[model samples]
Target: MADVWAKISAVLPGSVDQFPLQFSDTVESSVVEILKRCRQQLYSDSTGTNQTLYPQIVVDFSWEKLNTGTWRHIDKEWRRVYSYGCLFKAAALCHNSPSAEELLQAVRTCDMGLLMGAAILDDILQVIVRILQGEVRKSTKEDADESERTEVKRIKIQCPHAPAIKEELSVPRIKCPSLESFNTNYLLPLKPVILEGIIDHWPALSQRPWSIEYLRSVAGCRTVPVEVGSRYTDEEWSQTLLTFSEFIDRHILNKEDGVKGVGYLAQHQLFDQIPELKEDIRLPDYCCLGEGEEDDITVNAWFGPLGTVSPLHQDPQQNFLAQVVGSKYVRLYSPEDTDKLYPHQSQLLHNTSQVEVENPDTERFPEFSKAPYLECVLRPGEVLFIPVQHWHYIRSLELSFSVSFWWS
Candidate 1:
């Protein structure tokens, strides 16, 4: 064992460490070869079943070198790594287990355990490596042209029109005989008009304790930058905050730099924290689900108030924005008003203007001069539906708490 360890150490970099409990190099190599043979067999006879195992093990051998951070490392180069961890256990079970069913069950259990362990280890290693790399990079960089750098800071635009009248629109007082009648008569008929108390009947609203606790837990959770298809850890979950003040103090208020991007406030995976939301929110559903794919659900928590106005962008899904607490001003344009809005060709639903509504960049977004939209205030318990492809700019009126549900 000592001789084998010495040989591996001599061949590989000092950084290339493996756990002691893991398979030895010789056994690992043998397992990998067996997996490759199984894969080739699977490829030749796709339907063939092995009696010794629950299912036939499939393997494919592909050549890829593992990196050890040094180009001069000849011994580490051209190392053959097999991709069939699952197949290795299956083949092992087929060789040693008494019954075919038992062998198959053992293989399945072993493969699953190995996969989960590998995933957890991979996450830890990635984070550690990233941190180390960042530290090294930070220590090495001092560019001569750093002082020459400049960025085009976005400007805010103010609305030329005065604030629209805030009328207390009467909530529809129709009583339905049944859920069917409510859907057909009231919900269907009022598709054009925004409904005030749609959430009043939702069972989730009544389960306020669960909802509030969940929100607080999310807010208190440690926020990392958004990454694609990454799961939040328990450590991250513990940092989720319940109150707006907590979110701002921990994340937003202390940062001396100005905020950028509407999605920047809440760390990524906020949507994943919501157990009930299986799919993203969309627009057509807001317009009575006329047709189309569902909206991409986007849930972000803003720590500070959103200062600049957002551009007019239309989405395919219906929107159900649940403002937990906090205030926002939403300006909406109708789909029929597309000609005046001057939408960009790259995206059918987005306007050409990137100008903030509070400070329109006339030089770049000249067409925005003609764009007119209706304004509404979205408070807690109220959701504003902009409809599919409707142009809108949403600005935080105060330190706000909101969750938006979109579906087509």
Candidate 2:
């Protein structure tokens, strides 16, 4: 498999490989020639077709080296490029009919000129590379010669904090209920509410014993191990047993491969079998919104005994995490406590010290000593919501399956 993929990869030039030649001053001339050829092919003066109209150009490239020496035959691979099919259709629709003002209006209203420009650039670069080098190689010594000579400067970005809450000198203070109430009131007021027992209601677990087995089989579990976490290889993760019953009896029961040997589960199948889980899943919707929307949403699920103790980091969206089976411990800090967390030097808001939260290296993250936090134990069937820009770390307690939904 590795050899086959290596051969295939060697034959294709990825986008990054074509980047250096793309920005050359020669690109403009290449685009003009390609566009002119396209206009001629689609609308010729002899045919009485309008020459003023711009026809969309689809450009492609390939190469072959002639050998004079050997009688032996060797097949050489060639690279091919197709204009994004959509671009060609769009170009046909906008053909020479629209005035320059009308075209400018269309380009602005549709906002696709930039995308068209980028595609044209990509196609132009491929052709230029082929014209310059008769044969395509993964990379060439010429690439080093053409490398940008300018020094790159790093720019620092700053995140602005919300305005401070004004102190009310005249208003009377209300009393708290107990020590726990006072602790909640004075420290970490916006802590997450941890709920347990949601998994008990999951239909697959209750109605079918085979469902449990199937899940265990998919998870590659024999006797559930005592230790908390594990990671699996890709091949171990792809095996499919259709019904939950076949999964448990056939896959789970036969565990010659140790539990830890199991890799990631089939993500799509996991969602397909548990359709109800999709309702709560939040995918990033970036098209209509502005910048940062895409990076704000990320979902990750884990099956099998495993725990990830990530260093504290603040995200823009709130998190709704559900533990399907097993238990985990969580510790959280609020946005206001940024000063106490000992953040990084960059513009990133939360400078979560790289030191593990469970056991900190006080010498390096001395400011963490000033940070106050709330801790909770989340059990199977429960959900916990970590608020926007809050910091947290998780540790799995036993064999577990969990899903996390994050959104603004």
Candidate 3:
């Protein structure tokens, strides 16, 4: 029994510790619980039938058989390894059965030739940890990434998790329409519209080598907060503070692989951080048509490499998402489809839905299929109007830079 317990104790701790996300409890006993349920079903039955039902689980599993005809010890500790597949499935059939918990006690207290049990104990615990537990935690690393890493800490994630993006549609557009017509046709109706040839006059567009090199020259020394991840919804995502020059060096200049996992300078008040850079661009005239003061119109920067995503969500105020550096694909859905979008119930995330706009899960969020949406490939010198309460999704198609204004 000591050898069996020692083997079980050794592997269980390592498996729990190696799991990626922070677990509710480090010592997971789901497999042990499942095994107990399976045992009860086998022994306790109103009908005297010896038939036992088990779940059919498929896995690519293989392991060494211990204490056989020609067994050799791999190490000095004489640890025995036993591997089996569909073992968890048989146990998982007890997911919510009324079986009393006794297998764990039996396994823990079993002294049935400790040496023989030792051979199988370690592998059994490992299989439970690496196979069974791994199955349940496999999905939605993106969910963990978006809500906790980049989002405001006040937000909380609830069940029926956010939907993923699954469609791409075209958004409507106009070329420098009069402010009266713009308000009459789109703003008042709370609709999304794209404005063309809007930022053609900005000096930033004409700067010599206005690529990564020029950006480094201007705000290189400025310290700013950047979102470091391939997408905002990546599990490994987080926020970091870096000098603008250092950011360009580590995330841009030094980048060799691609734009999959790179740091992004986004939704930041770069205009306020480095006022000198603010001289390069001008705010659209459309903002003046609204009731807010010019000072009240908040301008924020969204800059990152290709593949960066701001998952499907809604904002509180009217927005003019102006593209200055590279192109971005913007998707817009009307507030009327709010129910289909599965907006978060929390007040902090209430303005945003849980659904991802790029790879949506129709089975989980079937109503999302019924929602109508508009999308566009926004290029330099163009601005996208996102009316207040409108849900939208944004993704960079290349290394991109843009400014957004939030106004009521």
Question: Against the true structure, what is each candidate's TM-score?
Answer: 0.43, 0.39, 0.56
lDDT for predicted candidate 1 compared with the true structure: 0.39
lDDT of each: 0.39, 0.40, 0.58
Q: Model 3 scores what on Cα lDDT? A: 0.58
Judge candidate 1 at residue 396 and give its lDDT.
67
**Candidate ranking (TM-score, best to worst):** 3, 1, 2
lDDT for each residue of candidate 2 in 77-168, tens digit (9 for 90 to 100): 11111222223223333344433333332222122222222334344322322221211121122221221111100101112222222333
User: Deviation in angstroms for 298 in model 1?
Assistant: 7.2
Winning candidate number (lDDT): 3
Per-residue lDDT of candidate 1, residues 1-408 (tens digit): 112213222322233133111333533565445544543432232333453232222222222122334535523212212223333333333332225343323323332322222332233322322222223233333332322122101111212233444454322233223446445754454332334555554433454422323333322222233211111111222222222223433333323354322322443344443233212222223334434333345544332344423445666655555555556767666677666555656553344334556676778777766765566666555655445555666666544556565555
Winner by TM-score: 3
